[model samples]
Target: MNLPATYEYYAVIPHRTQPAVLLLHTENGWSLPCWQTTERHFWQTCDHINQTIQDLLALRVITLRCLFINQDTGSGHFIRVYEFENRDAQWRPPVNGSWIGFSEFKTLPLTHQMQRAVLEAWFTEQMEGIPTTRRAWARTGWFDETARWIVEILQGQAIEVSEAVQQVRTWERSCLLRVATTYGQVYCKAVPAMFAHELPLTQHLDVHWPSHAPSVLAVNRQQSLLLLRNFGGPKLGERGIFAWWEEAVHTFAMLQRETVTHADSLIAMGCPTRTLDDLIEDIRALLADTETLFVGGKGLTNSEIAALRPHLSHFLNLCQELKTYQIPYALEHGDFGPANVAWVEQRPLFFDWSDSSVAHPFFSLCLFPEEMEISFPDTSDWQMRQRSAYLRPWVCYESLERLTRAFEIAQRLAPLHHASRYHRFILPHMEAKWEMTLMIPAYLRCLL
Candidate 1:
């Protein structure tokens, strides 16, 4: 696939207390303060914009909320508009930019038609206040309120807020903020309503396995926010140490084994129950919904869907056969992979519980082996060794041979499992469904 050559970012730097935006005098005309880069994703665009403003304008800014995205297909010129907050309100003025009032901006000539359109949309959004179509953090004043709340929480814990809060990452699913305090740096995470369970789930893990999870300092249940102490470690496989993969799988399996007896409580605490029987019914519904299964051009073709239909009975029988092994259901991290694991003090810290559920434990490793193979293609039988490490914790329930067979069965049905999850839990709550347009069909295609 050919990547876009350049991405032009427009920063809507709103005044601290007025309805005005910072505009720069460019060769074309007066326009919103802009930066250009080769980065594709909005988060990376935000990062580059922030760095450029800091270097040239000697001002610190945070780009948390995105207003618009457009791509010129002919030129491959990607345009992104983001709302930026100036951290240091008292700063030197830029040589070419000045704060232009909302009414005054309309009288000036813009760089192009697209710039005018973006500014008009932004001004309309400002007049309308916050919209329901986007996450709460994307609105004006959300960062200030959240930062104040963080300061209050940390101060109550005897830690003084020392530095400005910085944006770590923000996307459709969640927003991560880094807070610097006298004690150390802590992270504040805010999730949408769809994944509200993450807050309580992380707290539960912290209470049960403090050594393997980040410490939850405070929580705002109403906002689905969590403040976590820094784990002070690098991500698993960050340095390309392959042995960490085996250790991570072993640790994750032990967590599943330990949580087996708490399945009911976990479900009651908002963890979705994805039993094999439930998954089978979900698959049936998916196959019947031709409209959703064949929506996008990239979706499964008629021939592929026909081929997958015949496997329904085989999938049902596989689910039934696995039940004979009598392996108890437990906590399954729906999106488990090396990226979600942090290696701290010789132990693996597993986080990001937004996709967690109570289901077949073996289902957790369905994609693990494939991910490992892709990351370490030169290592022979690495998948087998990792599977062994994870399965050893379950030897008490069934023999290694029986457990391996159950794992295979779960792998065959994993695609349907993930497809059902997106169709049910994720898509409906998403404000921008286009971001995940291909996820369900992509997963379902694995069945063919």
Candidate 2:
């Protein structure tokens, strides 16, 4: 859809020391999914970020989108991006031609002329195969090329060993990159696994929850690269981090509903009755690898681990109990926790669906109160402790009370909200805990 012509694309000149806003003109309209629009509305509702954006635009920090069209040497079509030098409230002339592709180049100082040359050469390399053109590249695939160029830029930075990484903090995961040409932000992510699957999976999930997800901007699966919306949020355990327990519960409920519907569709498409079981087995296989469970953390000794066994065992029992009941299997946001959630615009955005799966309800909730309490004990405070203690027991008690108060106002209105099936999954986990707890005391004694 053509946005109103009044909207224009603008790129931000990254501050040498601080984060800055990247703005693109929205009057011409941008291609964003309905959900993203909803998310923006949420942002608009929650705070003055939109107003701040306007102020930034007034100060010349943000501008319109620059559409780069390639026409000279032909390998189809691509777009290039150039950041305007620091200016205030005025449209600057485009200094560089839009090349083969565009990505939010990193904010390195280009400290010296050599660095500038390197960046210039990198840009040149991207434009190498493409012919120059006067008109904007009309192709729909410009996004993909933009992603590729960004990856090359970051990867190229890796080769310049003379630059100390100390000043340049390298993120293990991809960084969020914003181009001046688009109103939306894109994630510069290198897929850990087959990157190709990441975009498709994200696209599928986006389609499923169109109202709650960021659209995939681009992908280069072959290079394990992706450029998608950066759903910004506070990190888990950080001060001022957002937590929406109610929203978390609600989203999961919606997911469960969707799972049933999706499963039925899959079955109609010829999926076998054993599909659920097979899926569970696959999940088990993934977890069976002790290394996978470690998640790159330091090894816990058998003794130190033994000390935590009772609590861990208890936690396991709860999972098993719920699993035994089968917990009404549905698609689970496998790593559902604070880290995976962003409090944007007063709503909880459940993210990092990389580990998502169809599992028992409590399986996902494992990452919630109890599991987090155990793993991040040092980080827990009085309030966190209270909430962690309160939430699960509250859920359990409420579910148990459901049978007694089937006709109660709260229970009737939210019947499925406290699914008693939680006990099924909890029971099996409880059983596992029973075994671990028994072994732990002996193991601890041996270690001592």
lDDT of 2 by residue, 324-371 (tens): 332354555545666676666665566665444444333455425543
Tell me the deviation in Å of residue 339 in model 1: 0.7
lDDT of 1: 0.82
Best by TM-score: 1
Which stretches of candidate 2 lie above 4 Å from their native place? Answer: 1-180, 194-197, 232-243, 263-298, 304-323, 370-448
Output the worst ten-in-a-row residue range by lDDT, candidate 2. 164-173
What's each prediction's TM-score?
A: 0.85, 0.39
Residue-level lDDT tens digits of model 1 in 1-448: 8975798877778877777788889888998777787866654334556778788677788776666777677888887777777668687457888888778888999986777777887788778875576888766567778988998899899999888887777667887888788878999999998888888889989999898888999999998899999988888757567888899999899999999988888888888888888887887888887767777655778887788888878888887887788799898888887778899999999999999999888887766787788888899989689879988999999999988888888888887888888888898888767566578888777666
Residue-level error in angstroms, candidate 2, position 219: 3.6
User: How does each model score on lDDT?
Assistant: 0.82, 0.36
